[model samples]
Target: EETHPVIIAGFGHFGNTVGRFLRANGVNATYLDIDSDRVALLRRMGFKVYYGDASRHDLLRAAGAAHAKLLVIAIDNVEKRLEMIETAKKHFPNLHLYVRSRNRFDAYELLNAGMLHVYRESLDTSLRMGVDVLKMLGHDAYHATRMSKMFLKYDEKNLKKLAAIEDREAYILEARTRMEELERILQEDTNNRLMLQVDAAWDDASLIKEATQQATAQTE
Candidate 1:
């Protein structure tokens, strides 16, 4: 049998999908889940899965954990997720470990466990949905992403700068003034109403339509 490379621990919904996608490509994947029902279902579905706890060294080693190219940890239970990550990091250091975290705390423990590539799975999806809402309301996708990233960076920078200030009210006032100054510097040289109109028409659809029509008219 040609051996599968990925060993996904915690074959819950998230992990199950990952295995299924890999299997569709003829890439065999081994699974580890504490849930007996899930394991049995996978086995019946013709997947090579282990009904075993991933934290145990023997269990992982038996599942070819050392030779496995990648380890996907998608256990919903935060405690179990950390345990799996710890075991993988300590014993299977050669394996690249990816973890799904439920919250900020879970991410912290994973990062502390020496795993950098940890994902708060639902966060990105939620953010994408929010961006889609903004897009439908006439925001450009590229600009929306840029503005979000820039605002986050700017907030963090200001927070650090204000960390040492003695008066909170004074800090707030100064920050507001600084923001106004920066906005004025960055904005187009036009009245606020005109700028708003420009922004409203700045998304991909409108921009493309305008560019194409203008080009066609020029050619004519």
Candidate 2:
């Protein structure tokens, strides 16, 4: 068995990106996947992927779970992902877990299970799209970016609150209330021109400089 600093289960699209970024930064991770075809393909492509179910205790131990500092759960199946979390926690109590959640509902289960590092797979991408739409509608690039950041912060905070409610009807009602509150707060911010203020890190001068350079290049 080889020792790895990071053990990533599920070498699919989500896990692949995480593994790639870590590899690019000079970090080596042990990758595990249930899909034999994908595992073989990745091996041919130079990725060190082991074919096995990560939810299994034996496979985790073989992957150096006892010594690995972090375990990333990026599997697509919700039930299997939760099972992996349980197995890892029971066997390697000290290993940090980074989980990939399908959505807010999936996130609630992970949160309820006491997992701290949960990544909602599509939240960031969806927010990025919202920012792009704002920019396309002639909003300031910096302002749009700031709004997205604010929205993410608000949504994350609200997710935790909503996750605690067990009743479906109660959850739906609270979710609706939160959505309305978010809309009102954003409206208030717009009316107050809070988002219009320039951020020093992304000031208008830099944007103007970039635009001027583009225009200059076009005429040349």
Candidate 3:
């Protein structure tokens, strides 16, 4: 019964990534997965993984949950994720739980349940791709990055704030209002940038010359 500091409840993509990185850094973790085939394959490859239903307290205990300081819930199923959270909270109250949420709605539920580190699986990556899209569309890289950061900050704050509102009508109104406000701010930013570009001293020829010189310097 060797105990590990970290216990991962899922062995899918997200959980596997964490486990691989942790192992690369010499950190051993006990991994529990419902997929018996994956468990057998990983065990054959010299990885320590146990096949069990992680939502069960007995399975968690068998996976060294009592001694584990960190429990990562990377299960994809919403019901199972909630069940795992409830079970962990009840049995391993001392463990620091990190949960993977499918969206803002899932995050709201986790936040309301008192889990502090709930990660939205797609939000950050999607925002990063959006920032790159803005850059490719001729926006300044720094500006695009700043705008993306601001958007993420506001969205996260709103997710937490809106979670407390119980009335569905009020929630919809607040969400709609926030969306309009964000659109207005972005529109203003776009107009201001266009105005600045229009008023710049350098015309197309000078801008082209500057770019040509930079490219020539890089080549030389």
Candidate 4:
């Protein structure tokens, strides 16, 4: 079998973007898809995509899963995605799995199953839309951007905490408490005059760093 640094299981819109970005950056990846039509279309566009069910152990082995450093699971079907995760974890223990989750619940399932890297498909885009809505409502661009960064950081951290709770009623209670805490913290930040004194341009890295630090300090 041929060896590759990465193996992507699906070639849909989400997986396509990932594949394109990796290829553009000089990274070689083995692509697999269950849709023959989609695979043909991608092949016509100069992409080397294999047609097969990625959840199958033999297909993954043939696609170089043994030596691949990362496995990007961007498949659409939830059941199939979970099946593929199980298959990968069972046979390719050395491969790091980067999973695409449909929502928070999906992420929780993946987390419970020991998947470390789970990207919720709509989280970042939804936050971006919120930032734009705030800007259109006469809020300062930098402030809106910073608020969104903080929200993202808080929600992600909260996701992990909520995921660990197995009891349904307990999870609901904790979730409500977390939501109230988030509102109180955001309100406090809004009232802080010192936080509004910054007049710098939008820097994503700095905003994310500040948000992470702020979240860490609050939890301490």
Best by lDDT: 2
State the RMSD for candidate 2.
8.7
Per-model TM-score, in order, reads 0.63, 0.85, 0.79, 0.85
**What TM-score does candidate 1 reach?**
0.63
Total backbone clashes of candidate 2, pairs 3 or more residues apart or in separate chains:
0
In candidate 1, where is summed lDDT lowest over 10 consecutive residues?
185-194
The positional error of residue 191 in candidate 1, measured at the CA in angstroms, is: 13
> Ten-residue segment with the worst summed lDDT in candidate 2?
194-203
**Model 4: lowest-lDDT 10 consecutive positions:** 193-202
Model 1, which residues run further than 4 Å from truth? Answer: 140-220
lDDT of 4 by residue, 1-220 (tens): 6688999999999999999999999998999999999999999999989999999999999998988899999999999999999999999998999999999999999999998899999999999999999999998899788888888889888899999999999999999999888877777887774444542333665888899999999999
Model 2, position 121, has a per-residue lDDT of 98
Q: Which digits, one per residue and each the tens of the lDDT, describe model 1 over residues 64-175?
A: 8878888888878777777777788789887898888775445555665677567766665665677788799997688667555554445434434444455769867877
Model 3, range 1-220, lDDT digits (tens) per residue? Answer: 8999999988888899889999999999999999999999889978888898999999999888888899999988889988999999999998999999898888889999999988899998999999999888997898788788878887877788888988899999998988888767777887887787776745776888999999999999
Question: Which of the two, 2 or 4, has more TM-score?
Answer: 2
